[model samples]
Target: MPTTARVVVLEGDFGVCAIQELELPDPGPHQAVLEIYAAGIEHGQLQQVEEPQPLPVIPGREGTARVLEVGSEVTRCKVDDVVLITPWSADPGREPELPLVEFDDGTETEVAPAGSWGTNLILDEQFVVPIPNLMDKEGASVLGNTTLFAASAVRTAGVGEGDSAAVFGCAGVGLSTIAAAAAAGAGTIIAVARDDERLEAATASGATETLNLSSAAAVERIAELVPGGVDHLFDCVYEFETASRPGRTPVRDGGSALVVGLPGTEERQDDLDA
Candidate 1:
């Protein structure tokens, strides 16, 4: 018997479609079959489409799953272990960041052994991070990537006690940035967004000040709260006109603007003007 699964495929230029009947091989040594639960949509997928790669590709970067089957050599998981699938599975001896999975398929897929964007996926045991006992499925779906990005942004901004910081978005990643910033001991944390609900969430997460930009003068409002300007500006809503333009303006003369959002080429070029 063969296993068929449904997956999202990018056929060609700006083309994304759902198709079933994907052929998946059974677990081989060091591999496992995953039953995917939730996947996060990141900007990498969109960029890959616009830039163009080989044909007939899947387009998700991260997800959580349950181990459905394990290869003979796989000892990390059994038939029902819950795990978070990082896009790339690295060599076991090396840390998770340096993934070593390779394929002769000659496609520039983000994951070393490809990825988990479908109802079912075959993954190497090394790529699967066990979901913590406390973390729910949604939490596990984004923990690894979200944690890495937050840590990277915080380090890039040099956040520390007595430093003032501002985050220009309140999406999941943006909220993660806020929590990381607060935990890093940033004296004043400001969050700006058009969503009142998200702003409230950011405040609860760690933001000392929340500004609703839904009306106007959003930057001015942020500036009023920061006074001398923030020590670090973390812009996650870099495409929105109001949020994008405020990063440079909100930073003190020597302060730095760390862009965490993924912007397109044109928008990035516009950032040069800042």
Candidate 2:
């Protein structure tokens, strides 16, 4: 008898189902079987789905695993290979061998590839990134996602050496933005958050200064710290709309404000005489 795998299943009725006992499939010419090590939880899961997530869906988006088998034509991975699977929604311009993973949690039963919170996952060769031996697994997992966001934000802001930058929000991505900004040589970094604990962590992480946004003057205070106003600002706060406003108003006339936060919306660009 072949081994059976337990996985989560999602129904179209806004419900999650847990299903078990799946028969494993043999690797395709470009596929491999992976034993999941760990997976990261992201806020994207909270987004409302219209089509009702595919039934018997596996909902994890990011995970680390070890390969157990490979397809006849697959050259990317072999048994025992540690890999981090991050399937991009866009054509990442890399390769297409990797299949996008989705989880369905509607039903109470489990299913394969419908959820990756379980032990085993079958993936394509192009979807796997080799885990480096020297890198810490726990740290690299978070860094992988953060680095991608940082790269895009940094590039969008045209951040470079000597540019004064301020980052609003002290969460993972915010902290990553701070690090990237500092590495890019932003002379000053002001990290903004609502509490003292996270603010302190932001400072320790790389923020030149930290401020609490619980009060109304948080934006004004940050401007006072960066007298000339920041040249660039990165907003990573999803709920706080004001975070972006301060950086937008306080920054120099020619400065740029980059909003990387979520809950996508359309806002008219502030009209300022350049």
Candidate 3:
């Protein structure tokens, strides 16, 4: 049976977001319907809303919910199971592209709309990961993407016990990386940012040292702390000049500099050249 769901839709015009009622389709053969309990709002979602996209699309990427119904082929979860809604499938073997929506004008466009802000959601079983019984929904919602990104960054950098790491950016992803690095037994976790509050948060998250990028001698100070640069440099902000400067580079020779954030088109071009 179809159900009406209140969804936050972003119109084609930039910066227009509103709630509207829409009929949600029933779960497909390999899908499940969920009652969303909590959804996370991140800076990436804010950037998405500001960019031009297909009209009247739902804008959300991470959430937590309880399974209300499942299709016949679904076996990973059952009704009433708490699950985290991940942007990609939990199963690494399968990679399914987002479904394309066709407009009344007969024009079709591939809009990767995640309708998690709605009261209910119907997603493929692959995208839902069963959550622990004691975990809070709000925390679980942000955990999926935030932790995954941090873990991926650590893995990419090959950070290991007694290794030194420098995280450039004290935002959600950067702070998460610090925590993960600490948990992995990193010898020194340095957090770099401009904001004092975020720097403090970074310290609490397990940063052994913090650098204020606004300071004129910040790069020199980092070099002074770790004479030969850090073993791993996680660039979460992707600032073109700062991240690519050879004189002020944060990574040691042959060390990995992992960029985990999206850069602007011009910056990307510059990065390619560098």
Residue pairs in clash, model 1: none
Task: State residue 93's C-alpha deviation in candidate 2, in Å.
Answer: 3.5
- In order, the Cα lDDT scores of the candidates are 0.71, 0.65, 0.77
Candidate 2: tens digits of C-alpha lDDT, residues 3-100? 24565444456554466445556666777787777766655433422236545455665677778888888776677877776653233464444334
Estimate the Cα RMSD of every predicted model relative to the unseen true structure. Answer: 4.8, 5.0, 3.1
TM-score of 3: 0.86
Model 3 lDDT per residue over 146-213, tens place? 67778878987788999888888888989999999998889998888889999999999999999888
Comparing 2 and 3 by TM-score, which wins? 3
Candidate 2's displacement at residue 108, Å, is 18
For candidate 2, the 10 contiguous residues with the lowest summed lDDT are: 265-274
lDDT of 1 by residue, 1-274 (tens): 2346676666667665555446566666787878888876666545655666666566666778888888888877788888877654446574332222222344434334335667877777877777664667866677556555776789888899978888888987789899998888988998888899999999999999888867577778767887888889887766666443664456788888877856645866577565
Instruction: lDDT winner between 1 and 2, please give it.
Output: 1
Q: Is candidate 1 or candidate 3 better by lDDT?
A: 3
Alpha-carbon runs more than 4 Å astray in model 2: 1-4, 48-51, 72-78, 89-91, 94-115, 241-249, 264-274
